[model samples]
Target: MRAFIAAICLFLLCGNAVANSVQDSTTPADAIVKALYDNLSAAYLCRDIVDADKYLKTRSVVEATMLAFTNKQDASETILKKWEDEIQINLKYQNQNISVEECNTLLRARTHQLYVAMDTLFK
Candidate 1:
């Protein structure tokens, strides 16, 4: 009877640990996506082209920034600062008000723009 109890306790503990680890592992991706969106939104709102440029890690983002800021080189610093500030605010509001649908829409628009630019640039 004692051995049975010990085995059950070990099983439960292990299962809990696995569940916790899985939850932890999935959090970073969400965090990354949130940060990306927050950065993009700040850039869009502030018209801070430079900061917007910084957040474009992918080709799509770069293309989007180029398209959006084609004539606004003077506001680069302001935009970058705005992006940083937005990131700080997002950290404070982490897991609040993030909309995956919005993120998808923004990403798709940026990517499509990027592809168009690539075609033009290559041509």
Candidate 2:
């Protein structure tokens, strides 16, 4: 009976450790950007230009600024906010001069930026 209890305890402990390890290994930033990209792409594919434009413009500016700046918490926050504001302004003018292809190009650039940022930050 004692051996059975000990074995059960060991199994639970090992399982918990494994779960925690997996959680720790997951990169939150990468996951966030990837999900954002996927959803944005889906929106564009569905011809939801408004939603796609919003996501792509906001993410593109933020990710680009983040990738360009040195890794610092304060700088990241500041640049991200600035980028967001810029994106909002740009979005207002989107209908006047923007095209689907341009949005796609910006999104691709942002994706590249995200990858570079993750590489630099994680490494």
Candidate 3:
């Protein structure tokens, strides 16, 4: 019984440490952006406009909410708002202007921005 309890505790601690390390390595923003891009890409590949629209709506909502909470200063807040608007507009366009190539490019940039923003906010 004692050995079993000790093993369980050890496993839990190691699991928690690994989870925390992974979370620390990637910001929530990065994960969101990556998921958005991935979903959009898969939708486009499937020629499924409905799924793409769903992802776009989800992305807009998440970005707007996150920016509202994470950015308080006027200057950056304005910038974040502008970005949120851009994302919304992108969704409204008939084309959506989201080709696989474009999505790939956007994903790269957003990933970097996510890390930077997270560092600034957390620090």
What is candidate 3's lDDT per residue for 1-123, written digit by digit as tens? 455334433332232212112343254444433343333333333233344564455455434534444443453344334544443455443366466665555545544544555454445
Cα lDDT of model 1 by residue, 27-113, tens digit: 322222233344354334323323344344542452344234333343333444444455556544344453545545555564454
Clash pairs, model 3 backbone: none
What are the per-residue Cα lDDT tens digits for candidate 2 across 28-108?
343333433333333333234445556656555544534443344564455445434443454333344556776566556
Better of 2 and 3 by lDDT: 2
TM-score on alpha carbons, each prediction: 0.27, 0.32, 0.31
Candidate 1: RMSD to truth: 20.3
- Which one wins by TM-score: 1 or 2? 2
Q: Give lDDT per model, in order.
A: 0.39, 0.43, 0.41
lDDT of 2 at 9: 34
Model 2 gets an lDDT of: 0.43
Model 1: lDDT equals 0.39
Please give the TM-score that candidate 2 achieves against the real structure.
Answer: 0.32
Candidate 3 least-lDDT 10 residues: 12-21
Off by over 4 Å in 2: 1-86, 90-96
